[model samples]
Target: MNKTLAEVRTESGYTQEEMSKALGIGISTYNQYETGARNIPVDKVKRISNILNIEEKDFFVPLKFTLSKIKKDE
Candidate 1:
């Protein structure tokens, strides 16, 4: 899974403050988007994708996980 937004932000070496400045938004708002506390508008998502040099669809990569069966004790 490659949920690209946060990964791209880190890979680009931009702090939240820097990213917010680049996107013309407040740091708190950007943090909300990054932390999933707020849903980022599509236009903002596009701007962030542009700043990170990635396509907006890259943000949709799903997280990987697995479920295991638990055994019952007799």
Candidate 2:
């Protein structure tokens, strides 16, 4: 199973504060990224990749959606 950005961070044993500091940003901003409230810049993503020693591709999560069809009577 794939994990979220927050999960990855926590699994790496780094707190939100530490990650924010390492990225030279505010804690709230980092939280927003993890919570999907804000979009992380490409450069920032690169920075995070370097910091976490993980590939940038790992950060991308594919979204799944289900669509329902309505039945109609002729």
Find the candidate with the highest TM-score and give its number.
Answer: 2
What is candidate 1's lDDT per residue for 1-74, written digit by digit as tens? 55546667888898899999988999999998888777787788788888888887767533445889989998
Report, for every candidate in turn, its global Cα lDDT versus the true structure: 0.79, 0.86
Clashing pairs in 1: none
How many angstroms is residue 68 displaced in model 2 relative to the true structure, after the best TM-score fit? Answer: 32
RMSD of 2: 6.5
TM-score of each: 0.71, 0.76
Which ranges in model 1 have alpha carbons more than 4 Å from their true place? 61-74
Regions of model 2 farther than 4 Å from truth: 61-74
In terms of TM-score, how similar is model 1 to the real structure? 0.71
